[model samples]
Target chain A: MQFERAVSVEHVQKNYGKFRAVDDLTFEVHGGEIFAMLGPNGSGKTTTIRMILDILKPDTGQIRVLGGPLTEATKMRIGYLPEERGLYRNVPVLDVMIYLGRLKGLSGDEARQRSLALLQQLELDEFSRKKVSELSKGMQQKVQFAVTVLHQPDLIIIDEPFSGLDPVNTLVIKRLLTDLRSRGCAIIMSTHQMQQVEEMADRLLMISNGQQKLYGSVQDIREQFALHAIIVEGQGDWGKLPGVVSVEPAANGNGHGADRALLRLDDQTAPGDVLAAIAASGDMHVRRFEEAVPGLNDIFIQVAEGAH
Target chain B: MKHLWIVARREYLTNLRRPSFLFAAFGVPLFMVGLMFLVTTLISNAEGDLDSLGNIGYVDRAGVIAAADAPFVPYADEAGAQQALQDGTIGAYFVLPADYVDSGEVTITSREGAPDSLKEAIDHLLLANLTPQAGDDALASRLEDPVTLTVRALDRGRDLEEDAAIGVIMLPVVFAVVFFISAQTTSSYLMSSVVEEKTNRMIEILITSVTPLELLFGKIVGLGVLGLTQLSIWLIAGALLLQSGQGVPALSGIELPLDLIVISLVYFLLAYLLFAAVMAGIGAVSNSEQESRQLAGVFTFVSVFPFFFFTTFLLNPNSPISVALTLFPLTAPLTSIIRLSLGALPVWQFVASLLLLGLTAALVIWMSARVFRWSLLLYGKRPTPRELWRVIRGTPMTAVGTAAQE
Candidate 1:
């Protein structure tokens, strides 16, 4: 179901009276990619998502969803999981799913079959006849995610996909999203949960107060904001090493490596040179050694606060 | 169009099973039929009045009676007649005034009420007093107490069937009641359905799948069909009642113009379109059920505003207020149906009312679609009238300060 281009928003601006909700924003999501939209609470990420889904119209720009404007026919090819997600609480789970799937242009049998399969995959088949309100929050979140992808939409936009999920369920959803992406789906996911974005998103965009603060591939953006430092875990006297200006505990989590440390280099030092020096030091045996790059969480915090 | 149909089907099916819809659909016809049976049974029983008024007492203020008889007991004064009435000497009394011969006016009072026997005795007494040959005149008059009522239509050159005339007059009232109840029930269902979707945040999910226009029309058409289902049941019940009610004399006779039922149905559609559109807009703009009701109340007030002046329309049919309500889309359905039922409304008023009602309903639906689209995603405090107006005017009101589900 790959289209020419999944979505292209050009110079989009949306305002509610004097307050600009989005301003001159431009971006595109192509097939077979996960684009993370990172922002704090009320940071226009949801607004931007709605704009792309054609739920909200941009004031002064053109948004071509699924190659052209988001028409009734094209709307079927897109899916959305809003932050304030909901299903018909009183309706049976499978019925609700089928209704939504049918609304998205799926045939009844196709929707029912797909819904049952998704429910089974998510281990929710037993609750298919139960009311949605009867499900636990985590279970409901899984159901919501299932509903989003039930129609196999070409362009999927999800907000806070893993907000209230346990690690196991989160992994399940993450894998599902990844699988969708592998099948040439263009997914735009918005969240403040930076770890998931770093793990799953190929490229990311950060918006605050309706303006784009950052937009690039996950690795390139991380490296762009990377510090001139290396992290060394295991037994090491890293503070006394040559070209080492300082030594401190790693604020960013470095996993279960023994005795972790983040080594800051001087202005004239190279990260490769520092790593070579660490290896030459006979006094140290390192478990993990890598150049330091700031996580998306820190960058998100910095950008959101800076915008304020 | 397919999406619209899907949405409509979902709405229709989902609400069809609602308790309120079921009750309105089935309960109303049963209730109306039961009421008709009860009322007609009582009216038929009432026609069997008591045969005698027992020992008639008269004040005889005119002193016209020469002497008292067994049935006729003359009292000297008004006090005597009252005393006699209280003492159980008489079951009822009548006062023939002092100028009885000249004016020929007689008044009667009875605790047993004026039964036919007492009334006929008085007629005899009057004929005997006024005529010298009292016995023959009284006997001749008593054989037949003559009066008759007959309705004839000169245009058709035939006497009206008593049942059909009654039916013609009663059709509008029946229609008005059913329509008023059904419209309020179904339109509110549409409103609350919209509000529920908004409250549960399901609008966001639906808006993505279908256009707002599709969403609005789907719901209106779906619930309109629901209303029609209810009306169909009532119509069947009504036909059953009309067929059976002809045998019950108190139900009288009915002659309904086929055009009346057809016109009522036409007005029902127009009324529903206007009402459902307004209600859908209210639901979209409101954040809660109470808010939806509060906003919906404005239309309720407008629709019923004509009722206060209903008599004016019935009397004049061309009064300003009457014409205004007949043309006003919200008030037109019941107003026109009722007035048209009474007699022929002028052709111009009928045509203009239909045209205006239809045009206004169409216009309101257009505005409601705009309002529905703009307001479905909005949350927090309800939007003000001015804000709603701006949205209706095609201004994009992005929900900025409010949480746009962020």
Candidate 2:
């Protein structure tokens, strides 16, 4: 299925004195997709988000949200959850949510009703009338999320969305994001959680030192960085195999015999060739054999190290 | 504009519902009422005690005056009067020497200061008794008050009514207090609100929905309205109290001129805007409430600097320092209001000062918006003076948009 663009950023650059915060950054987020912005601290992810939200204008770039420059009208269709998590600490949670919703163009009644439903859905109904300061950090995070999505924004940008959530609440938010995505809301989230991104993000852009290190679909990027190797479960002297250059024990400790090994292939060796050799040797019984795909966490470490 | 109103409404409601606002709005006036009641009661009780004192004894050695139907009892000699005073039969005693009329002096002995009413009674008794046999009641009255002067203003070609003179004397203080209260309350609110938003990093979320200008003006207008509401409540309550004859006695007969009232309100708004914008700018650059308040203190001091020169301005509205302060934007709102209250400010000066003040307020507001937008995302470190100048001059920070060359 074809997808329309929700946000397009081109050649965006932001500078703070001699320090360049973002450099020639270009990317696009499409409708009904989850786009993760992967970066370390001070990698200009927040600055890029601010530019997209039009909170800070890029010195030399164009950002089109909802097919046009950000304006007062366009802001209504966008929801933003900043990395800094805070609400009016002295105000009731429901009131803060409703106020934020109204700022996003919802009518008072609509804001209140939607906020009420969101609070209930998030299991925060009991604390709706409590001051924000009275809520726990995780609860406040949920409240912030509710406010972010209260007006049903067409595009949602959340920075560090699950920072303070526990395992259960994290799963809850993961489901919520997938639910929003299925409803055709475009989401651009920035987080340090590679596992979450690996599970959820359709595409991601990784930047380091204000420069793009990688960009593409998560699967494509992972495949491009995959090591040419296979994991085998059969017990054998895998390192002594003809095509095997090196053998490392698998960390999962799932070897059929005393050892499960990851056999690294030589330059010209194919994984199928290795499987045939393992079968022909018949010195070991094969329980499992599959190509090893690099996890996002490993890829992130590799790319970040390479950039430096 | 709609966003402005939305933000402003939130600010208004949020602050208006606070316990602090409610306490300030009602608690102060009630406290003042109770204080006034206590003071009046004490004063009246003291007066009653003084009036109940025993008759004073006097020794009239001059023999030219005799004690009549007064609070005094005559004694033949000083020794007898002293004895009566020591015996507590007389509350106090006065001795008149044989040459008292020529010396124009009398000695008094008392454990405490003589009451003013008792002294007046003695003066009346002496005047009545010393007059010649042909003297009439009219002559006795003339002796009490030898001369009386009535003042008339040549400019208006009429005598100044007692109440008008009193109004003239009281107007400056009234204007000063009103302006001080309104500006102090609203500007502090503006500063603290901005600091609060910035500290919590909510400014980032807010600016996404509204322009910094909208946010700033929203706070100013919202808090301005709140301050006006507070002032109105006080004014209405005071007026009611005055009409019921339960207000401060000194303010009972004072007339508040319509023009003065109108001018005072205009100055209140202008002064609030000027100071609020300055405070907002300070808040934008500050990282915490403590820092913001410290900076705000400077502006507050400058705004109230005119009050320190109150006597100078009231004594001579055209003094160079007074005129300079009245024209200087920071002090103009208060100084102009005070000059107008003195009932002597020239029309041209009034218009010029107001125009200068209004223009300055606009400029400050615009500058505040720019500063706020530029610095809203800045955290951890305060901007340097050069960066602040750049913001004020509309210079985009060179560090903000440069692409990282890899």
Give lDDT per model, in order.
0.80, 0.81
Quote each prediction's TM-score: 0.81, 0.88
Give candidate 1 misplaced runs (Cα > 4 Å).
A3-5, A15-18, A59-62, A251-258, A267-281, B37-170, B305-324, B395-406
Query: Which tens-of-lDDT digit does each residue in A1-308 have in candidate 1?
Result: 78657989899998766777788899988899999988777767777877777776677999998879888788888888988778788888999999999998889999999999999999999999999999998998888898899989899999889999999999999999999999999999988788888889999888888888899899999999889888888887788888999988875573553477888899999988877887788888887888888888888888888888
Q: Which ten residues in a row have the lowest lDDT in candidate 2 chain A?
A: A251-260
TM-score of chain A of each: 0.93, 0.93
Query: What is the C-alpha lDDT profile of model 2 across B67-103, one tens digit per residue?
Result: 3554678898888888887888888888878898899
Clash tally, candidates in order: 5, 12
- The local lDDT score (0 to 100) that residue A208 gets in candidate 1 is 82
**Candidate 1: clashing pairs of residues:** B163-B253, B163-B254, B164-B254, B164-B255, B167-B254
Every candidate's DockQ is 0.48, 0.52
What are the per-residue Cα lDDT tens digits for candidate 1 across B1-406?
Answer: 8887888898889888898778877887788789888988765555444234468888877767765457788877778888888888787788888888788787877777786656766777666665555446545464555533355432222243444545545666777868776777789999998999988988878888887788888899898988888888888788788788876754546645577778888888888888998888888878899978987898888887766775686456677788788877788887887777666367787889899989988998899888887777777767778877877777745453245644
